[model samples]
Target: MAYTLGIDIGTYETKGILVDHAGAVVAQAARGHQMLVPRPGWAEHRPEEDWWGDFVFVCQTLLRESGVDPRAIKAVGCSAIGPCMLPVDVMGAPLMNGVLYGVDGRAEAEVRDLTDRIGEDVLIARCGNALTSQSVGPKILWLKRQRPELYAQTAHVLTSTSFLVQRLTGEVVIDHYTAANFAPLYDVQTQGWVDDLAEDILPLERLPRLMWSNEIAGEITGRAAAATGLAPGTPVTAGTIDAAAEALSVGVDRPGDMMMMYGSTIFIILRAAERVADRRIWYAPWLFEGEHGSMAGLATSGTLTRWFRDQLARDLDPAEAFRQLATEAAASPPGANGLLLLPYFSGERTPLHDVHAKGAFFGLNLTQTRGDMYRALIEGIAYGTRHVMETFADLGQRPARLRAVGGGTNNRLWLQATSDITGIDQEVCDKTTGASYGDAFLAALAIGAVRRADIAAWNPAAETVAATPDPVYEKGYALFRRLYQQTRDIAVELP
Candidate 1:
């Protein structure tokens, strides 16, 4: 029987899956890793250890456990958290740690400088996006200015997925969906790399060759096969960012369909009928040709919960901590007994895009318990998500259907809170294997094994989180927005 293998490199883990032609799972394996924070406002990963190492481990494990013949796997697909920044040497060795996505705000000054030099309006018109922490162009400029010596030796700039695909197939390529984040370097109209917007960022020649997400990039080499226990000369598709793959896994193909990914961060993607060029949100060419995607996200969601467990819930067992915390949070009522939290620990993304915004727990009282604090934390993330939804609404681009995926979906309180706050129902698919599953499907599509519409058959909707309006949530959301506006000046001044 024919099969497809898919793997995804995430912020804290790597997951690989083997699926048969009928969409039945043959084997699955995973490995966990840490996201390095070398300094405040900086996030990074060791490309070799965290990305390629985990990939090799997971791939080997899946093959051994499933006992599937290497040649039976017809195609391979890969994805990763992106648009990360990593410079490699002539031999493709990493020159430095990979700079993560918007969560890393080290290039804020570069973002400001670029915006000022090339007016925001012009950037939006040409690049289809405005300079923000999510844009890789500023981060490239930051590296050029801050580490000129290293920049001189840099041979190529790549994101996480590009690094992985290059390692696997010896092909230096990037998908357009991920390339859109390289604003000023990627012109949306032309759908190609351009250095005219800002020649100072870096030479466009250093960028990867662009391709669509499902196109075949190259075949896995003998060296890559030896390292990962896969067959030599296996085809590998040009993969996309993890979020886009996750959206596809859940059948988010048509315009007005949205995917609310509850992973390390709360990333939202809405397939648009056409380009929605608003500075408040991001726009990118969809995974397929002749399509567009509008996106938004929060700086922290699951990561905030992890921080809380590590710091405050240390008394609980590490494996059971999240479950215990969720139980505690569920006990607290809608408003957390008048407590509120601003989930900006790593600054804010999306509508605000404020790198200096600080996190806070407002309206704390002596009566508040750990349960109340935890509930408020989850609620804060929900409120932030609603803020993004409101921005989409303002643009006349409300999603007709919202599908939720990722690890955080297991947290019932967080899921329900988001629906209640946003007043939007969320559909959860049967197979929540997420991006890796989507990768396998994309691999199948690349080789003409399946059609786009086949996704619904592969993973159909299993449940729905119906929206329930709550007066308390409405009141809390108002305070949440007001609190941010009133304290913005002070938050930016801190440290």
Candidate 2:
């Protein structure tokens, strides 16, 4: 029987899955790694260890555990957290640690400089995006300015998935979806690199060749075959960012369908009927051709929950800390006992796009317990998600459905709170294996083993988290907005 392989490099871990032609998950494996935060606004990942190394382990382990012949895998697909900025040499060796996504705000000056030089209106008209922390163009310019010596040696700029694809297939290519995050460097109308904007940062030649997500980038090379257990010449698709793949895994196709990914960050993607030209949110060509996508994200979400576990709940065993926190949080009444957190620990993205935004707890009282604080953190993230949803409504592009995916979906309180706060029902699918599962499905589609619509059958909506109205939460959501607005100036003054 034919099979496929899917791997995803995430912020904190890498996961891989093997699936048969019918979409049954045959086996899975994962590797954990650290995400480095060298400075307050900087985040980096060791591409060699965290990305490529993890990928090799996942590939070999998945093959061994499943007892499936590597040759039986018809195609391979991969997705990762992006669009990261990694400079690599001509041989595709990473020059330095990969600069991560919106959470890394090291390019603040570059963002302003590019926006001023190119003119924001022109950029929006040509590329359908504004210069922000998420834009790869600014990150590239930051490298040239801050580390000129290293930039001089750089041959190509790549995101996480592109780096993996090159490692696997000896091809340097990026999907249109991730390319859209490159901002002024990629032209939405032409669906190609904007030479003028890109040349200013790096020569157009340094950019990866663009392709659709489902297109075959190249066959696995002999070198990749040796490192990975897979046979040489295995077909590989031009995989996309993790959120896109996660969306696909849950059948988030067709206009108005949306995916609310609760992972390291809170990422929301809405399938738009047409390009919704809004500066508050990002617009990208969808994974497939003839489709459009609008996206928004918070810089931190599950990461905050993890932080709470590590710092505050460290007395408990690592495995028991999260459970204890969740138990305590459930006991805390809604509104988190009058506590409120901004959920901008790294920075804020979308709508605000304020890299200087600081996380804070308002209305803290001595009487409050750890559970109240934990619940406040979850509520804060839910409020942040609601803010993004309201932004979509403001643009007249509100989604028809909201599908929740990722590890955070396991947190019943968080998912239910998000729905209650956002007033949108969330559909949870049976398989929340996330992007890896989506990668396998995408690979199957590329190899003609599965039709595009078959994802619905492979993973159906298992349950719904309906909005629960609460007057207390209604007041809390209102206060959440005001707190951010009032504290904006204070955040700006924080050194």
Candidate 3:
């Protein structure tokens, strides 16, 4: 019997899964890691502490629990957070901790400088994106400007995937979907370096080779094999971001199907053949080869809820607190008695794309209870999601249904709230956050044991929940939309 392994180095955790050829997850193990914030806005992960150590632990745990022979595994695949910049030396040692996604605002000066160098309109015309903090080009430029000496010694710049691939296969490679985020550094049209863009910052000679996710990067080295309990010389695929792989696992095969990943941040990945560029919405690659793919997202989703539950309601036990809060939230009819939450604790991304936007509690009343507040918090995020969805339709791509994945979908209230706000049905996966399941499926196809057409047969049985918008609630949501739109300026102005 053949088996495949899938691993994800997530923002807050490292997870590894062992699956047979049939898409059945035979064994799974996970370990949580810390997210270091040295300053107010900077987020960093020590490569040795978070990436390597946690991955070794996950591999050992999964192998021990599964009781399967390591020799039987055919291929290994990985998914990780996207577009993070990691500088590696010739021996492939990390020079510094990776700079995280656009949400991490430490590179504001670099963003401003680059925007001035390459006009925003010309950038949009060439690469289909204005330089947001999300792109690696700005972060690379930041390192060059701030630490010129370190930048000079840098041999190659790699993302989370490329760093891991270098360790496992001794190859420096990147997947196109993630590499495209390094805009202007890479020419999306020509699929190579953009010498004309950001030339002052750094030489673009060493960008990792861009390959499709299914392409084989290289076999695991003997050293990498011993570190994890895998057989030597195992082939590893050039995989993708956790959200993109999660979408594949939930069966986002066609353009109409949207993936709503309720992870550390909210990611909406919609597949489209045409380039859809809106300054408010992030328009980038979405894991398609030789075709245009787009995604839009918010900076916070599950993390904000976690912060609220942790800092605000620490005294209550998790189940007891969530049960109490969810029940209270469910009791309040839609609109939450005129209370609304901005959910911009970490600033807003997607449709709004304003880094200065601060979270707010709008229309709060002295009569409102904690229940109303909790409901508003959840609804605020749902509203943020709705804004992105509305943008997709505005650009001529509309998702008929959202396949809910990640730990957030497990909450019935959150799932139902997603349906209620969108006025569309949601298919909550039997196993929410099933990237491994998706990886297993892809691995099986990569080995030719399964056909691409048979994915529907392997899809986990999902409970379809439909939302019928109430006239009263619809009227209230209209006000919710108006509040954000009308007072966006005020929200951005807050300290």
What is each predicted model's overall lDDT from 0 to 1? 0.95, 0.93, 0.77
| Model 1 misplaced regions, further than 4 Å | none
Which pairs in model 3 have colliding backbones? 406-433
Residue-wise lDDT of candidate 2 within 197-284, one digit each (tens)?
6567888889999999999999999999999989999999999999999999999999999999999999999999999887899999
Alpha-carbon deviation at 251 in model 1, angstroms: 0.3
Error of 3 at 306 (Å): 0.5
Q: So what's the TM-score on candidate 2?
A: 0.99
State the local distance difference test value for candidate 1.
0.95
**Pairs with backbone N, CA or C atoms under 3 Å apart (clashes), candidate 1:** none
Clashes in candidate 3: how many? 1
Which candidate would rank higher by lDDT, 1 or 2?
1
Model 3, span 88-141: residue lDDT tens? 777778899988776676777777787788888877777777777677888888
Error of 1 at 74 (Å): 0.8
Task: Please give, for residues 204-259, the per-residue lDDT of candidate 1 as tens digits.
Answer: 88999999999999999999999999999899999999999999999999999999
